[model samples]
Every structure is written in C-alpha cells, then in structure tokens.
Target chain A: MPAPKKFSRDQLASAALELADEKGLDALSMRALAARLGTGPMTLYNYVDGRDELESLVIEAVVRHAAYPPRPAADWREEVRTLAESYWTTIRRHPQVVPLIVARRTTDEPTLEFGERMLEALARSGRSGRELLVAFRLVVGFIIGFAQGEAGAQAFSPAGGTADEVIQRGRTLPAERYPRVVEIATASARGDRAEEFRAGLDLLVAGLSAGARPASA
Target chain B: MPAPKKFSRDQLASAALELADEKGLDALSMRALAARLGTGPMTLYNYVDGRDELESLVIEAVVRHAAYPPRPAADWREEVRTLAESYWTTIRRHPQVVPLIVARRTTDEPTLEFGERMLEALARSGRSGRELLVAFRLVVGFIIGFAQGEAGAQAFSPAGGTADEVIQRGRTLPAERYPRVVEIATASARGDRAEEFRAGLDLLVAGLSAGARPASA
Candidate 1:
C-alpha cells in the first residue's frame, strides 16, 4: 500500500490560515484542522504544540507574505508607500488574520525583520532614528486601524443596508443639529473609498515628509 | 417604607457604562444591569428596546462625556488641539467604548456638533471642504487607533512583564539580524507610557499643522 501522507508544521499552518479565511477565526479549532488534514486531533499535536503555537506559526506565515521588496535605493516616500501597500494587501487578502496580527504581542522573528528593514529604509532617507521609528509605526498603525474599520464595514454592512440607506439614516437627523456632518456625509457618500484611503495616505506622507529633519546631519 | 428608586433610560445607560468600566463590555448583560438597578431584567426593556438599543445608548452617553468646549474664537491650531484633546480624554476614560464608536454608522447629535465645530475650525484654518473633512477624520482615526493599541497592551501586558521583559523578549533574535528594532525598542522602553502617547500625539499634530492652510485671508 502507498504510504500515508505526512503533515508538516508549514502545511498545518497553511491549512489553518485557509480555514480562518474561509470560515471566521472563531470557527477555527484543532479538531477541525485535523479533520481537514485527514488526521486525528491527537496526531495533529505532533506538528504543533498547541493552539497558541499554531496561531503564532500562522501569524508568522501570514506576515511573511506581506514582506516588502528591499527598500529601493530611492526616496523614503516610495519605500513607505511600498511598505504600506504590501501590508495593506496582506490584510485585505486575509481579513481574519488582521485582528490576530494586531493582538499578538510576540516580537516574532518575521515581524522584527520587517521592522528592521523599514527602519533602515527610513534612515537611508536622512530621517533621524527616532523620527524613522515613529514614522514607521505611524504608517503601520494607520494601515491596521484603517483595515480594521474597513473589515468591520465589510463584515457587518448593516445587514443589507445600501449607501443610500446609510445616508438616509443620517438625513433623518435634524439638519440644524448635524449640518456639517450631513453635508460631509452626503459628499462622502458620493466619494470612493479607495480615493479616501489614498487621500489620507497622501496627507500622511506629505506631512511626514514636511516634518522630517536630520537628527545630526 | 421608602419608595423604590426610579430608573430612567439615562440612568440605565450610565449604569451600563459603569459596569463596562469596572468589568468590561463583554461582562455587561441585561441581567447584571437589572440587578445593579435593583429591578427585574424585564424592567430594562421599558427604558431600552433591547441589548442593541442599550449598547447604542451606552455609546451615546460615553460620547457625551467626550464632548469638546464651544469653538473658541481663537487660532485654528488651538481650536483643533482642544478638539483633539477632548477626543483623546474621552476615549481614554472609556477605552472599551471605542470599538462601538468606530463601528456605529450613525453618530449621536453631540458628536455631530463636535464635528461641525471641527469643520469650522479647519475651514477657518484655510482647508478646502474636502481637505477639512479628510484631515479631521485622519486625526480622529489616528487617535482612536492609538487608543486601541494602548488598551490592548493594557489588557494583555505580560503578567510580571516589565519594559525589561519586552526588551528581553526581543533580545532572543541575533543583533545582526534586527539591530535597528532592538535599538529602537531598547530606547523606547526608556520612556514612560504616558510620554510615548504624548510624543506620538505631538508627531501627529506636527504633521497636520505642516499641512494646514488658512481658509480665509
């Protein structure tokens, strides 16, 4: 008879990530992962120590997919934008993983590597060590924050509410009470979400560029 | 015998907020709130429609606490700082409410009023209507995002883990591999948490101020 298939830690983590993406994070369990892998739950423990270790492995795998190209020998702006877009794409592709990425405190090797590359890129652009670190965090925090809001919107979406439904609900409020919000909401409703993200990113990059100064030039 | 205490919608919501503050949002329930008020769970329905309504009401109450002062007839920078600080203080006081605030599609009246004042302040500072709205949201989004990170850290701080613990955890990686992260993290640990928040806020404000242009000549 043919030998039975073997499950490696990498394969197990990949399968777990797929399960999280297809179903939600809450639905993920060792039993289910084992079932998917054609192995008993106890056998799966041979690959991963426990759920926490499995989750950490999954996070590391997911983050590795999000890595940027080594910073271009160019302006910090391009480097920051590349890093932001890479990270954003990763979160967008695996919406379920985003929350886990945000919550996990481990300075795991992959994440530290990502941080080091970003810091070097910022430093090469003439930013001080402190400004470089802070700006790197600003971009990371902004993307994660924005992704959280976007993911929540995609998940809930008012249970079938349309853009008009949202705007109509806002308009029900007294115009005198929320004139500006009403006005902005009306305008924003007509606006594209991608455009808004880009605009905010532009402002952030511009603001950071304007603020950047050499610590000891 | 003395009359039983009367319960109002505001009172119920206030009690819920208090419960959330003491325990957490997850622990809040109709039964517990009713018990806190010395009334039956059915009694709460008279004030709030359901769990959803109670949550909405609690958000409104917390937001009311986050209200800013009337738009000061002063420079736009001071006005924006005041608004931002009001927001920061409000979210800090009720960190649990932030996710709800971010998720809700329709903001309460007071929040809208606060937005109008902010828009006016930005307009006075010379931002176009779109710029004003985007910039305001960027600031609000960043503050909410920062607060979430801080709250998450507080919630999951390694038991018996000091700043040194965080540093020691990172030290497992070879210095040659993650020198910059190790350096920045080591330096970051030297500052107090409060100082870190202030420094981040300063970076954001400085970035925004660099982008500001007066609306009126």
Candidate 2:
C-alpha cells in the first residue's frame, strides 16, 4: 500500500465538498470520499464515525461559507438578511447540497454556532418560546422555499435561455382555464426572480417584526 | 417475451410512487421502477419519456392525492390551507419525494390543475402580476420550508424514538453562547410542530391578503 495520507478534518470536508460539487451529494460515500483523498475507507473513520457524521461536517461547511463566518451583528434584520442572501447564493452555486441541507438535522459546531447567532439577532424582535421558533421557521422557510421556486423556474428554460420560455409555454395555457396563471406567466417571463425573492423577504421580515405573538400570550 | 403489459399512465405513476415510497427517491430509476413493475427498463420508456418525465408524473400524483382530488372550492383560505396541509402530510410520509418535488419544475396536468386551483384561491386576495406569483411562491415556499424544517428537526431523535429526543438533545447545548437557542430548544422539546406550522401558514396567508403589491405594482 502507498504511504498513509494525512488530512485535517477541514481538508477532508473540503475534499468531500468538491466531490459533492462534481459528482453530486448522493455520490459522497465514505468510500468515495476516501478514494478522492487517496486513502482507505477504514482510515476515514478516524475523522468521522460514519457517512452521517461526514454529511453533517459537509453541511456545517456549506452553512459556514453561506453565512459569512457569523460575526457580531448590529441590526437583527440586516444580519438575518445577510445570512439569507449568502445562503441563497451558496445554494445557487452548489445546488447539489440543497437536498443534504434540507434532509440533515445540523448538530455540528459551525451550524449550531450559526443558529445561535440567528437567535441572538432575533432576540431584538422580542418574540420567544413558540413565537421565536416560529419566526425563525418563517424566515428560513421563506429563503428555502424561494430558492426551490427559482430553481424550478430556471429548469424550464432551454440552455442559455431566460425563464421567458416558462412564460411562453404558459401562454398556451387556455385563457379561460388559467387566466391568472397565463397573466402571471407573461409577467414572470420578463420578471426578475431575485428581485421578487427580495420583495418576499422584505414582506416576511416586516411581518415577523410586526410580531407573530399576542400580547397576552 | 411475456405478453406485453398494458397500463395507463396513472397506473404507471402509481407504481413509481410505490417504488419511491418503498425505496428512497434516490433509489428510484427507470431501471428500478421497471423491476418493481415486473417489466424491463425499456418498457418504462413506453409510459414516460425518461426519468425526468417519470418524476413529473410522480410529482403530479403526489400533488393530486395531497390536494384531495382537486374539487371545486368554496372557501379560498380553506382550500389553500388544505393544499398546504395535505402537502405537508404527503411529503412527511413520502419523504423521498421532497427533493424531487423541490428540484423538478412540475408542469404536469395534475400538478398544473392544482396550481390553477391555488391561483384561483389567491385571486380572491386581489393581488396579481409579480405580486400574484410572489404570493403563490410564499405560500408554497412556506409549506415546503416548514416540512423540510420539521424533517430536519426529527432527524435528531435516535431511531425508533419520538422527535422529543431531538429536543432533549438540545439541552446539552452550552447555555452561554446560545441562551436563546437553548431556551427555544427547551420550549421546542414539548412543542407541537403541527400547530406551529399551521400558525406560520396563517401568518403568510394574512400577509399575502394584506398585499405585497404597490398601487403601481
């Protein structure tokens, strides 16, 4: 056998990330990662317990890169916005990780730290308990939901084409059967999804700040 | 060869759904699906163009079953609410399809019918154009986002245990850096995720009705 290779956990994670970027998330088995690292799968256990832990590390890394290292924040909304925007960009670039991010419960250090920072930022909003958790859910759900929507819309376009095809395809939608859909399709063909996502974000943030809590509760 | 099998597209979609339900979504392939149907992989092409078209049919079926046979609506909110709730339950049960649903831009007949119904419900809210599309995105996003959030939260529990284990695991989080997280975690331990999901949905619907549209918009 070749001399054993040495790699830090970060190095391992970076390698795994590249593998995911290249071959897709489902392709990131410990064996594949080990192969990518020029090492044995058994040796991979030194860094992680199994594929699950390796995935968590991968998720943590993606989230860390997405959140801009989570510095101390002045404005809760701005910080939250920054996190959301970064997440949007990160997911857009690395669509492969979207499923992993969605499916895995992130209990890793970086992700937890990021979560803590989000809660800290929201502390200013004065919603706690169920209200606090729900607020977090709303913002996060919106970001993820928007990203999925944008992805789906983009998938309709031919190569190097705008989402106009999605719109054009809808014009064939019978006017009587789906008037609203056709109209929206027309507007959406020429629409900027990024601008619309920001608008939705603005609305959610305003509403969250407007408060999901009742005074008596 | 054995007598050629004759199955409707719906029948094929149902089989595919069962395959997805049994195996994870990743395990789903034209080859695998054909095996499940006791047919050769080439036979699947007769029903679907390929894996992409097959996935659309699968998504359409899920959307159909989840939305309660797509009956004409009376209460817009109730119908919209039904769509979101059933979507939640369907995805929770068929967790495998979540990524497929997220990644595919579904324009299948059943799925489109459902979309038209959702748009019909939202038309009552008096928002259209980009605002209309954004409203639809918000509601859809919220449902998908909440489902994904709940799924991730449940992942923390030890296998074969209730999600309470996930909340219980949060107690070990250091209190200093994550007071809010710990506090929320403590509350979430005994919390009702379903109730919270419904609450969040109500807020988004209310916000959509309140209007994200400007006078000019």
List, in the given order, the native-contact fraction of each candidate. 0.26, 0.53
Runs in model 2 with CA error above 4 Å?
A: A1-5, A22-54, A67-79, A152-176, A212-217, B1-6, B22-45, B49-54, B68-79, B157-165, B212-217
| Cα RMSD for candidates in order | 5.1, 4.8
Model 1 residue A179 CA deviation in Å: 2.7
CAPRI category for model 2:
acceptable
Candidate 1 is scored at a TM of 0.75
Which pairs of residues collide in model 2? none
lDDT of 2 by residue, B97-211 (tens): 7666655566666566667778877766667788778878888788778777665533542131234666677776788877877887887776898889887877666666456
Q: Candidate 1's residue-wise lDDT over A79-154, tens digit each?
A: 7677767767776677676666654444656666667777776666566545555665566667766665445432
- Per-residue CA lDDT of model 1 for B1-217, tens digit only, reads 9567487778988999999888777778999999998989998987777887787778778878766665475777667777867776786778666555554433555667677787777666667546665666666666656655445432122231333555555554567878877666655556454555555556666666767673342
